[model samples]
Target: MSTPHDRHLLVVGAGLAGLRAVEGARAAGWAGRITIVGDEPHAPYDRPPLSKAVLAADEPPPVPALRSEEVLETLQVRHLPGVRAEALDTERRMVTTTSGELGYDALIIATGSAATTVPELSGVRGVHVLRRYDDALAVREAMARSREVVIVGAGFIGSEIASAARARGIGVTIVEASERPLERAVGPAAAVRLMQLHADAGVRLLTATTVSGVRSTDVGVDKVELSTGETLAADAVVLGIGARPATAWLRDSGVELDARSGGVLCDSRLATSAPGVWAAGDIACVDGVRSEHWTAAGEQGRVAGANAAGADAGGATEVFAAVPFAWSSWHGHRIQVVGETTAAGEEDHGDGFVLYRRRGAAVGAVGINSPGPMARLRRALTAQTNP
Candidate 1:
């Protein structure tokens, strides 16, 4: 333990990003005290399997939490669970949480994000959003029953849930406001393929569809009113719409948050506008853009934790570089995408594999239903950075 004036590193949020940050700090030989706080009652566990593997089965994936209290104890890091940060006293270098006030030398904000929901339909029967483990459990319980399941949005989450529901022989209809299910992430060209995959899996997918309001009966969903003035009968509704960063409490904290994206701004070194303060994870919007993604979130947290520990983080020269990536499995087929995939860009590599080039370095690449290309691409990307 360091001296009293040595400045303990206070990390808010106990997700993967936060855990990774603590590890990075310890790796940098920051003998100072390190404490992490989180609002969730559970330890920091893996989230990716919550939707695909955990919810799909009767039992949730046994997530032996990473860098938890035990791991933190080994690293001589403090863990403060069941606390929610309310305000930040940047001038005094102190943070006020529900538990108490903690003065720190540096702070790492990795609050992550929350599920976007239609609160107006809260009293309704069965409207759900997939964000937390409990949300998955509730949705999974509903998925066990065979009823008309109306899924809002055809994004990865929506599609994956639909696939899971379909796997159990549940009826699923995907409602997308856009023409393509995942046009926003993978671009229209690749989204078309995903849409085809949905169709092949017996999923009812409607494009250019808008949900006016959700009205469900006591038993379940009666019908979903559409903007086009049509009603589709449904038993349950799962809203897979995008998520907004949880940063409402940070207002007036003088921390620079993106007005449009709703994410805390940070430099390449992961330092926020406030001195000795940094932000990370989905809640943070580093480099103006690129706020989402598990890998990016973890990487951001690691960099922030390292820099906050008083290391030569290379300042703004440090680049948070990671190929935009996400993987999903549907109907026994696994899909992997790496690099910059857009919803509108026209991609053609003559054989359906996309290769994103910047100054002829192949900055990004996307391949569908092909692990060979993905493995090769991952190797190339890693070699470029590792070498």
Candidate 2:
């Protein structure tokens, strides 16, 4: 191991969580050599806008860099853009990348996730998955030229893509396998309201349906066949089914990973099974739970970074226990869900907010275009979880 004077901190996957991990290390008083690696050449950028503002913009927007080169320079962070981590060797504390081998005193795995794709539509033109910056640009260009867009899955990403397509005056059809859109996300009561919002927006909602096959020409897709013995005309298709954590590189790294999700398994302190290693963001499965939201990723990154630094310095590590929170916008209406809305008793106010209770006490909430109630409910949930 390197001495304290020559200690180094290496961060893989230069996304939101990776950027925050660097910052968190500095905030925790880590003065070691810091290096961040990213498979993408561009700097870290916000992803939520890719489905919303980026697609709806008349002109292509600039790359939404989360941090400037100057900021990274000020932090003394050496960023290795476009360098993919190929493998890891926890025994030697070395990471094999596309460029060269990297040794670190402490390592943070923040690879985040990649968009899940349809197997049948593989290598077909006009099929898109919005996870990277390039994917969003390609989809935006496809939306501009297409007349009708078929989005698979009615989750938050799919709904936002539908809203963006409609904003461009393009016809949208959302094919969801679930009976109700967002049924598992915001629960049944709130999901009904969300479905109404989509219907009011004039987007076609095809529930209990699955894409069976696609008819593609030499140039692009022209039609989509559903499982219900129905086919829909489409010039473009967007797959928003879900995302898998980017953890294939860690399979043989001696790091414990969740078998189902392929996420790195960590404790409350974000420490991995391997020594001198920690995981955060989407790739982190903390106590058997993995959160894919943006807020959770950033929060986990901060905590993991501090803990990794503390491990190097023999300092006290902090626990990462917080109420889950996520927010999304669909057709100009805000949808916010906080805490565990799945198992709690829901109280629909019929206004715009639904409160979730357990044992006569508030535990969570889902707000539809109601920020005031969401704010209050989130505060209450935070207090409840903390106390």
User: Considering every candidate listed, which one attains the maximal lDDT?
Assistant: 2
Candidate 1 lDDT (Cα, 0 to 1): 0.77
* TM-score, per-candidate, Cα-based: 0.90, 0.97
What is candidate 1's lDDT per residue for 106-128, written digit by digit as tens?
Answer: 78999888888777766577888
| Tens-digit lDDT track of model 2 for 79-108 | 999999999999999999999999998999
Q: Ten consecutive residues with minimal summed lDDT in candidate 1?
A: 310-319
RMSD of each: 2.9, 1.8
TM-score between candidate 1 and the true structure: 0.90
For residue 350, give model 1's deviation from the true position in Å.
7.6
Best candidate (score: TM-score): 2
Give me the runs in candidate 2 sitting further than 4 Å from their true place.
Answer: 1-3
Candidate 2 lDDT score relative to the true structure: 0.89
